[model samples]
Target: MPDIKCSVTECEYNSDVKCGAPMIQVDHNNVPKSNNSDQTKCDTFRAKG
Candidate 1:
């Protein structure tokens, strides 16, 4: 599969390349549930091993 580049630096799943999971699911609390990109943040992100 092609690499999925993630912009979240703090997420353990985030490397220089793609997310470890085949697909990533972010919780609404960790990431904002709105249209505003500036208000979004993922505090619960973890690397899938």
Candidate 2:
């Protein structure tokens, strides 16, 4: 675990501004690095209703 911090309150795995998921996948468009937060997405994100 990399101690991922998250603030997506609507995600089922988000709790107290932290990620409670067993594992998280950060997806990028085959880029070596992302210059902004919008360039990536949390593949582990699951909608909370």
- Among the numbered candidates, top TM-score falls to 2
Off by over 4 Å in 2: 29-33
| Model 1 Cα lDDT, one tens digit per residue, 1-49 | 4676777655677777556555655444445465664556454477455
Per-residue lDDT of 4 in model 2: 77
Clashing pairs in 1: none
Query: What TM-score do all the candidates reach, one by one?
Result: 0.39, 0.75
* Full-model lDDT for every candidate: 0.59, 0.87
- Give per-residue lDDT, candidate 1, residue 5: 74
- What would the per-residue lDDT of candidate 2 be over residues 1-49, giving only the tens digit for each residue? 8777788989999889899999888898467788887878898899998
Q: Tell how far residue 48 is off in model 2, in angstroms.
A: 0.6
Model 2 scores what on Cα lDDT? 0.87
